[model samples]
Target: MAKQSTLDKNILHFLGPKHWLTWLGMGIAYALSFLPWFIQKFLGKALGNLHRALSPNRRHICDVNLHMCYPEMTIKERQSLTKAHFESMGIGVFEMFATWFQDRSKTISKVSFHNEDVVEKALSKGKGCIIIGAHFSSIDLCGTHMARYIDVHPIYKLQRNPVMNWVMERQRRKIFSKTIERRNVREVIKSLKQNKAVWYAVDQDYGRKNSVFAPFYGHECATISHISRLAKSTQAAILLYDYGRTEKGYFLSLTELEDYPTGDEVQDATKINQLIEQQIEPKKAQYFWSHRRFKTQAIEGTPSPYSK
Candidate 1:
């Protein structure tokens, strides 16, 4: 075996004691997974409520997002939504455990697909597919089930925790057709040109250079324009890929775009944002509100929504 680097040794030392807590939580989640589905769900709801109470910083972020997006709603209404979102997020943590370690067969059985034929039809053409993925709390679980149906090459970021990162990558490799690093633009384009399905999420704010200030829920949020470039360059189809967590399980779908890559980057980006809004509208609490979505302001001197 190769010798461990000093950094590796240090990471191991730091993680040695603390890692057990994560492992213990994983154990608890796994145990709960075997129980009746409703019971496990109840446990997740309880856990989420506890987390919402304890995690003030995250709750604050959610509050900011909800307030900005739903300006018409009363503070009380937003608070209620935030509470429910946290509960969904709490259950999502358990869902991650289920995606990574639960019986693949058992979890896979729970997922249902809608309008998947759209993806198949797109791929049937010579041009590849760009699956416009979004951040929902149960994204990992959704991706796992979606991979069972299509050979989706998902874009992912490296985990900060080295051991956990390795585990995550390994689990993804086992499930998805292929996993692409978020920064690998070349691979993404190549996959698209080769007529493969590449899943990409452009909702997060990545600052000024590569993004444009686009309207998302009436707010000028920084949205990536690279997706437009990719579509134009490869002439690939843009399909909306998102999942909703129902009382029974997850409902994942792929909705094809009619006139995307309209040769106007901002317009295409706006259309993408609109599609995302449509998906998140009905299931507001199910969407991933924990992210600092409006961090990058369109105005030069405006305050960031996330600035405390």
Candidate 2:
């Protein structure tokens, strides 16, 4: 493990500064996205033309997810949706940069909040709740906006680029100073004890030893057990939050999980996982399907639905 850490550090050092790349990419994308309505329309049409000509990996990811989640979808319908998904992903990339680089008012105006009472109620109890978030549309802004109403401690997996990490750390701290690394389990526990809300993006590919197989999109996938463990230890209420894009703009919604900490850890985790799936199902195109979510397989001799 020490050797692996050293290798990782060396690789990051080799990459050197990444802040310049981030700035250049973000600046160009934001400017393009904010062009005049007529100009932006032309640019969008041109991009659509290019999209039809090129075969992006995002298309494949969308197709795979659609196939897995909606086996009943006809191939033609799936293809059409996959095309729209890639276009949306492209637009979302630019929207992400615009949100990150632009002023808070401009970005926050694009998102609407719903069921804020859920968070207020949790905080009112003075025990702080665990917010389980996923990488859906405009997810980063969810934490940013929530911070305006209450203190939110979000967990992030640091990047390899030291310079880029420093830049992002500064930007993130502007809204949330209590950012914890994924490996800092002790720190997370301490924060919960202090009655601080901790936000976690639980839908990711954690290896077998650290995660348990859970059903997602009708397939068994390795899901993080940390949230369940923390809830069991601290008795914190579990709430799921997601941001979905609307025709007008973006909107945030919170769903409170029923019967949290019912003395069945696995069952509790399964329920939370199902709630996350339910949230993602309606906004399938916005979900980050590029991630290899089912990288870890079920144990040998078990019927693995996700074996690809």
Top candidate (lDDT): 1
Against the true structure, candidate 1 reaches a TM-score of 0.90
Q: How much lDDT does each candidate structure score?
A: 0.81, 0.68
- Candidate 2 on 1-308: residue-level lDDT in tens? 12111212433453436356765654576677565434543454456436645855545655676788789999998877666655555555555444456556756666788898998777676677888878874565556677776677888887665544554565677767577777888878888777888888888877887787778877777888777778877877777877776767678777677777677656765776787787877777667765667667777566433343
- lDDT string, candidate 1, 230-288, tens digits: 87878898888878798777898888888878888788878889989998987899888
- Candidate 2 structure, TM-score to reference: 0.81
Candidate 2 residue-wise lDDT at 205: 78
Candidate 1: Cα lDDT at 84: 92
- The clash count of every prediction, one per candidate, is 0, 0
